[model samples]
Target: MNIKKYILSFFLLISLSLFSQEVAEKRDAPKPEIKISYLDSIKKTFVRDDLASCVDSLWLKELTDLDLYNNLSQDIQTINFDEQVDYELPTEVLKARLQEMDEKSPFHIEYNPGLENIIKSFLKNRKRAFERLMAISEYYFPLFEEALDKQNVPLEIKYLAVVESALNPKAVSRVGATGLWQFMYQTGKQYGLKIDSYVDERSDPLKASEAAAQYMKNMYAIFGDWDLVLASYNSGPGNVAKAIRRSGGQQNYWNIRKNLPKETQGYVPAFLATMYIYEYHKEHGIKPERAPIKHFATDTVMIKKQISFKQISDLIDIPIAQLQILNPSFKLNIVPSYKDQAHYLRLPQDKMAVFTSNESKIYAYVDREANLREKPFQIVRPIVPQDSINTLQRLAQAKVRYYRVKRGDNLTTIAQKYDVAIEDLKKWNNIKGNKVAYGKNLRINGTDVEQKLSAVAKVEVDKKAVIKDSLGSKMDSFYVVQKGDNLSAIAKKFNISVADLQEWNKLTNNNIQLGASLQIAKNSIKEDVVAAPERKDIQYVVQKGDNLGNIAKKFGVSLDDLKQWNNLTTNSIALGSTLIVAKNEIAIVTNKAPVASFKKKEEYSAPATEYYVKKGDSLYSISKKYPGVTISDLKKWNNIKDEELKPGMKLKING
Candidate 1:
C-alpha cells in the first residue's frame, strides 16, 4: 500500500511540471501587431482642395457629358428601347443581375441606384457605343491583359482604359493629357514614355499599356484598396487623401465618396458600369461589331533607318490610314532613328514576308525621295497688288532682341522686364515650365515700352562696348556663362564640345556658375598655326534624324575620339555647325579609308552575363538590369542597331 502511494505522487508531480512548461511557452510567444492599411494612413494626412488643383476641369466635364458617348458611336445605329426585353427589366431583376456579377468578378462590383442607372443607360440608350467598345476591346483588351499580367495586377483593370480613352490610341484630354493612358507630359516622362518631335510613345498601344500597368501597380501598392486606386487614378492621390480626412477618418471608398471631387465620385461608378455592360452585353441584345484588326493579325519589325509612313504605304501598297492606325506613335508620320538605337515598325501579319523581301528596295526608295526633296521648294506667290504694298508697310514692324536672364529671375519677372505676357515669353522661347536658369538667353520681342527705353539702352550699350574694348582680343573671344546655359547648349552655341569647355574651365561636374568666363577658341595664340595642326574644322549640316554616331562613322573616327577632340559631353549637335575633326598631322597613304573598329577586348572589364529577353523588354529597359551596362554598349556588343527586343532572344549583359 505504501509503494502504490509513492507511484501516485510521482505521476502527479510529472503532470504539474508539464502543465507549468506549457503555460510558460504560451506567455513568451509574440502577440501580432495591429496593421494599418494604406487608406488609413492617407486619412491621417488628408487635406482639403489638395487634389482639386491637379485635376483638369475640362476632363471632368467631358467625363460627365453623356452626349460624348453618343457622338463617338455616330456610325452605328442606336438600339431601339422597345426592342430589348432586358432593358425593360424591373429594378429588382437588374439588382439581382448586378449581385450575381459582383459575386463572380474578382473586382468589388458594389450595387447602387447610381451604378444601376449608368448600366441601364449604357445597355438601353447607348447600345451602339457599347457595341463599338466591344469591337475595339477585341483589338486592345488582349494587349492590356498581357501588360497587366506581367505586372501581376488584376485583369479587370483593362476596363479602366475604356473609361479613360474609349480605346482610342490618339485620345488627348483638354488639359494636355495624351494617349490611351491619358498621361501628362511630366508624368509620361517620369514613366519612361518618350515624347519628342517625331515619336510620342504614350500613344503606342503596347508601350502605353505597359506604362499604365506600372502606374496602376504603383497606385495599388500605396492604397491597397482597388476602389481607392481607381479614385486616386482619376482625381490623384492627394484628393483621395483629403476626401478620407473629411469623411471623419473613413477608409472605405463609399464612406468618403461625399468628400471626394464630383468627377472622382462618379469615376468608380462609371468603371463598374462599364465593366458590367461589357460582361453582359449579349444579355442586353448588344452584339459587337467586327473589328478592323484582330489581336494576332499584326507583327512588328525593327527599322534600322529613319523612314516615313508615306514611303512605306506607297512602296508596300498599304493604305496610309491603315498604317497610321497600326502605328500611331510616329508623330509627323516619321519613324525616328538614332545612331545607337532603332525604331519599331508594325505591319499586318500577312505583309511581313513581303516587307522582309523588299526591305532593301523600300529603303532605297526612301533615300531617293529624300535626296530629291533636299532642294527647297520655292512657292511662287501671286504678285501682290501694288495697292496692298502701302498697307503692308503700315503694319507694325516687330523687332527682336536677345535678353540675358539674371539670378533671382523667373518667367514672370522676365516677362515684366520686357513688358510682355508670360504666355508670350513661353511661346517665343519654347519654354515649358515656369522656372528659368541664370545666364540663359531669352529672345524678347521689342514692345512699345522697350521702344521708349531704347534711348536709355543705347547709353548702356555704349558703356558695354567700352568695357568690352578694354579687354584684350583673347579675352574678348571668351563667352560669359548664362543663367540657362547647359554644357550641351553652350557647346552647340560656340561650335565646340562640352569636353573642351570642361577642360578649359577645369570643371569636375556639368554645373557652371553664372558670369563665369569660358574660353571659346581652341588656341590661346592669335596665330592659327599654334592650334593643333592635325585638327581641321569640317562643316557638317545635320540632316533630319542625323546623330553624332552617324557623323563619327562617316568620318572614320571613334565616337569617344570625336567627343574628346571636340570636347563634347553629349552626342547632341546643332544642325549646320562646323565641328573640329582631329586627324593625324601626318597623312597616311592608303587607297581605302580606315574602318572604325571596336576597342581592345581587355578594355571591356565587365563579365558577359546571358539574359533571355522577356515580353515588354526593350534594349533601353534591358540595359537597366546589369550594372555598368548601357544601351549603346549593348548595341555595340550585339551589333544591334534596332532597339526592339523579342521574347526568348538571348542577349549578353556585360556587368
Candidate 2:
C-alpha cells in the first residue's frame, strides 16, 4: 500500500507541472485586442488628400536620390509571387494584430482605414520595395537601434528612416534635404555634420543616425508624445505647435490633425503603417532579400592622409564602389588628405585586417602615384606689371560663357572656335587631357573676334581653316592621337578638315589608331576676305514629339529658317519623317591649304569576353581586361562596397 501511494504522488506532481507550463504558454501568446474607440476617432478626422499628398511627396523625394538599384519598380515586379499567399485579413483582424503588437511599444499603433490602406498598399503593391527595405534594414537598423537605444529613444523610431530615405544613405530630397535621415543643409550643419567638397557627413549612416537620434530626442522632449514628435519631424515643431493652437489647445495628434500640414497629417499614419507592416510582414509571406553587406560586417579606420577610392581599390584589391558605399561621405571619391586631423574610412571588417597589414605598402603606393601626378602640365600666363591693370582687364574682360562639349568637340577644336589657345582652355577648365566629355560644360572666355562671329560661322571657318592648313608649312605641328580619337576630332584639334586629313593620310576610310602620330598645318588665309557659307536648306528627320520651335532651337537655326526650308504653314511636324532646315544665313570660312596626314591603324585588341579572378585580383588587375571600365565601374557592377574579390569569382567585362 505504501509503494502504490508513493507512485501516485509522483504522477500527480508531474501532471501539475505540465498544467502550469500550458497555462504560461497561453498567457504569452499574442491575441487580438478588439478596441474600436481609437479607430472611431481616427475615422472622424481622416483626410485622404492630405495623407496621399504626403506619401507622394515622400516617395518623390525618395525617387530623386535612390541610386543603388536601377529600375527598382521593375526589379520588384520580377520577384516571384508564388510564395505570397493571397488572403485579405479583415480590418478588425489587422487592428487586433496591431493592438497586440502595440502592447509592447511606447508609440500608439492604432489601426484605422487610412492606416490599413497604407499597410495593404505596401504589402500588395510595394512588396518588392518592402523586401529590399527589409534586406537593407539588416545593415542599417542595428546602427539606428544602437544610436536610439543609447539616447533612450523608442527603438520603433528607426522606421522613420524608411519613410525618410527608403534606406538609401545618399538620398537627397527635392528641398535639398539629404541622407538617410534627410537633414537639410542648415540642420545638418547645425548638428555638426561637415559639408564640404570632399565630404557630406549628412550621408554617413552612423554619424547621421546618431544626429537623428539626438534630433528625435529633442523633439520628444518638447512634445512629450511620440506621434506629435513624428509630426514635428515631418513639418517642424513650429508647425505642430501652431496646429495644436489652431485646434483649440488640443495636444492630441488626432485633434490637431486637421490643422497640421497635409504632409504631417499623413506622416504619422505612414509611420504607424510602416511599423505594423515591418513587424507583421512575415505573416503576409514577405521575406527579406539578402543585403549586400550585413551589419557588423564592416569596420572603420582613421585615415591620416588623403587617399582616393581608386588608390585603396588598386592597392588592397578592394572594389572602389564598395568603398564609396562604405564611405559615402567622401564626395569626389577622395579621402581628403588631412594634416593634424584624421578622417575615418569604413571597410568590410575582413578587408580592415588586410588594410592594416599592408598599411605602409598602401600608403607608399598612393604617395608614389601622387608624386607622379603631382605636377600636371599647365600653361603659365606671362606676368604683367601691376600698372597694366587696364590692359589685363580688357584682355580678361571675359564674358563667362558656358559651352557644353558636343560629341565631336576636343580641346583643340573648342579653343580654335573660341579664338583661345588650347592651353588656355585647359587652364580655365582644369582639364588635364585633350579629351572633353560630352555634355560637360567648358568655360569659354570670348575674345573680341569670337564675340563678333556667329557660332555656326565660327565653326565653319575653323573647320575650313583646319582642312586647308593640313599640309601648310607655315603652321606645321605634330599630334599624337589619344583614346577616343577620330578624324573629325583630330581635324578639329588642328583646325583642319576631315577631307584634308583623309587626303594627306592617303586613306579611303575614317578609321584612326590610338597613339598614332599625325601632322597638323595652320590655315594661311587672308582673314578679312573669308566668306561665310550661304544659307541653304538641310534635311532633318522629325523625331517623335518634335515641334518646329524645338527643332529650330536644337539645330541653332531660326524658326523662320525651318518654316522656309520645309514650306510649313504651322509649327508642327510628323514623327519619324524628314523636314528640311535651312542653314543659318552665313558661315565664315578661312581660305587655307591642307597639310595633315591621318595615320594607319596600329595593333589594337578588343575587350575580353570573360575574366577569371586570380589569386590577387585587384581593381587595377581586373581593369586591364576591359578597356574603359574604371575601378568605379567594377565596384558598382559587382556591388563591391569595400574589398576586392577572392580568386575564381566571375566579373563581367564590359567596355
Best by lDDT: 2
Q: Count the backbone clashes (under 3 Å) in each candidate.
A: 10, 21
The 10-residue segment of model 2 with minimum total lDDT is 592-601
Query: Where is model 1 more than 4 Å wrong at Cα?
Result: 1-87, 375-655
Residue 75 local lDDT, model 1: 15
Candidate 2 Cα deviation (angstroms), residue 343: 0.9
What does candidate 1's lDDT look like per residue over 85-148, in tens digits? Answer: 3457578877787888778766677667666665666666668777767876787889999999
Candidate 1: 10-residue stretch with minimal lDDT: 587-596
State the RMSD for candidate 2: 30.4
Tens digit of lDDT per residue, candidate 2, span 162-198?
Answer: 8887788777766788888889998999888988767
TM-score of each: 0.48, 0.48
